[model samples]
Target: MSSNDKLPQLAAALRFSVLAYAMAYGVSAHAASEAVELNTLSVQSSVIGTSEEKDVAKYPGNRTVLSQEQLKKTAATSIDGALQHVPGVKVQDETGTGVLPNVSVRGLSGSRSERAQFLMDGVPLTLAPYGHTGQSVFPATFNTLDRIDVVRGGAAVQYGPNNVGGVINLVTKPIPNQWETQISNRISAYEDSDNLMNNLYLRSGGWLSDDFGIQFSANTLNGDSYREHSDTDVTNFDIKADWLISDSQELQAFIQRYNSDMEMPGALSPTAYEADRQQSQRLNDDYEATATRWHVKYLQDLDWGNSAQLEVLTFGHHDTRNFVWGFNTAGGHWADPAQPSTDIRNSPREFNVYGVEPKLSMSFGSQDTLTQNLILGMRYVYEDVDYRLRQTNINTGAVTVPRDWGLKTDAVAAYVSDELGFMNGRLKVTPGVRFESIHMNFEDRNSGATDSNQINEVLPGITAAYNVTDEWVAYANAQKSLRAPQIAQVRGAGDEEGEVSWNYELGARFTKGQSSFNAALFQVDYKDQLQWQSATQTFANIGETRHQGIELSGRYATQNVPGLSLGLAYTYLDATSEAEGPNKGNELPYASKHQVSWDATYDFSGYLSTLSGFYYSDAYSDNANTVEEDATGATGKIPSYMVWNFNVSKELYQQNNTTLSVDFSVNNLLDEEYYFRGVDTSPVGRYPGLGRSYNVTANLTF
Candidate 1:
């Protein structure tokens, strides 16, 4: 390298040395503080659990944290709207209202968001790992989150199964030291719709006693969506309490509940869609969901320099949907494209699930120069399900032919992990392993059929990191991740096999001044790829599959324009089924080959402005690689598309702990005409993308 290059490197190294010295001194000098803040993303300790907050720089995994400030840039109404800007992540607009999003990471399937683990304050938010909606997860409301933490690789070893793709933790707002209340409301405009979107939120918290505090919140979402007959009404309630037993012990508890009801406009036929994208014929389709959750945790400081914690969580969910769908099938084919009599089905499902987990964490070191963190955990989960299906008799206009199914499941898991650091924390390594045992029983009372299955698996992971300089770091990781077999495959998972993958990744991060950059390359090899067959309603463990991708994300502050910054996130994926499969060399279904999201932000004069857009490459919807649409209303490919969005917000009040703000945003600025998803074997041919819309928000806090 040239001397000019060496000069920059030398300067960076010197700066890192000085900063390290300062941070080390601060750690030793302020040993009594609650937590030491190293950066925006990292902390010396946390209050949520036993491990506290560790240094983000020292963690070897590929992770990202979107802070509250970043979230305000767009003031997103849906999780999908916010996560769309993240590289290596896919967020599909399933219901167009953010009520139901298919979010996946690292090219994994996200049909129902079952490809990854979703957490709330580091707790599992999902129940059954099999079936269609069996493994669904929920974490309060999107507007209530203070931040989001994402780990792309090796999260399975530390968190357990269902993390093969990644882990997403929605961090909630904490209670303030003093009493406070906040109210927020929003009104939005939709395409070809007279009814406006109305949303309301209220949050309150205060210290009830010298040693106790509590936080409570309620939110509601109602009114018209972007499409006809797609109106929605949903409400959420949350309560959290924190009690301090002593200076060394603390207890925390949380409860949340929600009820949602909505009308699904259903899909538009090809002719109808071509005429007017907003047209819909299935007006009677409806969906309803209700859920409740409870959590409790206790933390103890064992004095000297060690701590331990215990935690438990349980939740129940019920989902019901009655829809008349599909265009073509063996028994029923639509002649008019708008009416399919045989496709009418009413399905109502109920799930009662509970889980408990206990974990212990220990910290050991001498003067903080060298430190080792160890964690041991055990988990138990149980779930019961009741599903009933009834078909409508078109001739008689009455319900007929009923099918009822029941299921029970149990899961046991254990894990141990260690984080070892040396060389004054310049280098660190993390090693972990997990064991899981699962049992399931299913019965079809109407058909007199029963099935039982059990499966066990072990997984391991390791990661290493080197902080070469304050401005630069390098990391590498290898991990094994697993996805539990679907309910259809569970009949013989013991003799057959579940989906598994081995992931390898290497990455680097650099930061200078107000600019930061990250780049990573990863490859995941699957042993048994579960291929879903729509015709048979079953999941088959196919041969091998490989997914490799390069992810890039960065931020740059303009030198001449203060408060102006540019951000970029891009991904390139090569996801293919192994050559041994019947569809060898073909790209995985719905796995886009390229994706890019960009943003420009300006913050000044108490006003924050943002402009953002995303582009996605065309993707196949099935393994068969069929491109032409069949007579059955199934298409082979989803076309490529791009979407643009804009937002601007300003603070109206700011004094002490009281504040108020207002913001406005527009999505699909260009009125782009496109399809979000395509299917080759499905009854519906395509799902059109969301159209242009406008949103206005007002928030108050005191």
Candidate 2:
């Protein structure tokens, strides 16, 4: 096709790519329906007695799936806290309430989940990834998801964009044919802190001539948390409906709204931190974020056992934040900055996002012998963002708007994946390719600066697996990922380059009798990696970095003790900067070089008990590898610490498919105190960790 002809074709195919954005959401509904018996009206785990988790897990790739049952047992306060045991992920709890998350994969940057992909029910969740590349503002609770699927490897080639880190799909509640409802209440406290939460869910079907289903859910959390002056409140609501359009067609729609208001409390200086970790530096500053999103989808089931889908999504996101506090301008070295500076400002931003996509996926050949699965799709997405900041003069009591940034971006993406199975389906190979074209326009209102950048790239990946037996599998894969420059990084015809990486992995999975485990060895090398410097507020190609690691996780049931289970997960990583710059040879911050987690559980009759432990190795606090001797909170060297949690729950009653459950748990069981993250840009960067705490919850389901 000629350049002009291809351009139109690309635009036309964008819708399919948008459908791909949601990752077969309609199919998920179909699968959930089939898995749940119509007669059973309950809020049970949708993944129970199913191989979907194992099936989604590819050989030679890094993947982890958390089901509803696991979420219940953990009763973690934050989504990041629940995922702490998963390998290849680093989560820092900035707000104790899960309102503020700084997460990373492997050793990539974690400022706002910029290096990874975040999805909810297959739909993207961030404001405008290409425009700002941050997710620090959008945080969700763990109780709202039926499951969480994480994929990290070349096989992610089908998941476009920030596929550089991995893909995180937070699956929403499924629509079942039966009627169900659930109510949950929780209260928690520390020696000096308290929390409160409530959740309600309702689902029903068959009102529209036995061919439709609808579901509604609402949940809220509020608290005066472990940190002083750090209060948080969040509310979320969702609605889903599906209709059987015809014998061969179906329709589905979903809508969700979220709102959050949180206070930062500010990080403590080294001295003040050592004196007391519960003090607040910014007492009156707060932030608010809100979003409303909706989507419509249509699905067709072809007579040949193939399927097609079309989807459209629209949303608006807004954030208003006030930062009026003193912070260390120099790096964190003392209890408080020797020369502190107060920055008083109010910043507000908004995002208007829309997307459309259509996709065709098919499977052909004998079911037990040779089967081929293919998926083709494209998507067109547009985003408009407005940002402004107003600075206040304390002495003069005047407020002046000093800056404004306007960013508009249009993106078109197309992708195809083919999976071939052989030897009675024991062996499988999948190859995929994705094409992306992006055009971004930026206007600096204060400077009268206008510039535009357009870029495109093709990403490819391959994965192969062999099932040696019913209980064992071996796999290997190699793939390349690409990331375009952020809107702020590019100038009109500037020399800034995009980011790329090649990943290679080998792994195996095994299950037998009462034990199962997954192990893998992986290495990711980057070229022209992008790093955002807070000091200068700019992005630069940091040259090169290498991330290699060994991941192992397993669980075993004691042979003699029918109700006892033990679990363990360990990760060893060599993630270091090799760009021959100021950070050369220095290990990345946050993600520990050695991470380990273990849990022991006892499940007997209606009562269950679990004990979990977490450990991290010491790491550097800054790129310069600076180290301090004092136990000061701002020591350039991050100190290693271990913490534990204990939980026990009882099913007080169960009859007629109805049940009541009560749970009690303790976090930071020993009260060991330490910090996991630090901002090296200034002295006000040392954030104290949470102290010991306890919680109790009651859940009723019918």
CA lDDT, every prediction?
0.69, 0.68
Worst 10 residues of 2 by lDDT: 40-49
Q: Which stretches of candidate 2 lie over 4 Å from their true place?
A: 1-52, 56-60, 194-209, 304-341, 367-370, 400-402, 492-495, 531-539, 558-560, 629-635, 679-683
Estimated TM-score for each candidate:
0.87, 0.87
Residue 85 displacement in candidate 2 (angstroms): 0.9
lDDT of 2 by residue, 1-702 (tens): 122533454465454444454454434323222222222211112111122365444344667777676665664766777777778787766667667667788878777677878877666776675666677467456667788877776545556677777777788767655677777777778755444433333333323457788888887877777877777788888788888755545677887788887777766656666777887755535677877778776665432343233333333344433333343224543224334444456667777666776666556665456676667776677767777777665556566777687777778888877778888778988888888888877778888887777778787888888889888888888888777777556654444556888888899988776577889899989877866767766666776988999989998886799778888999998988889767887887665799998888888675798888788788876666777633444547778888898888999999996889999888889998887544322234467676788888888877
* Candidate 2 local distance difference test against the native: 0.68
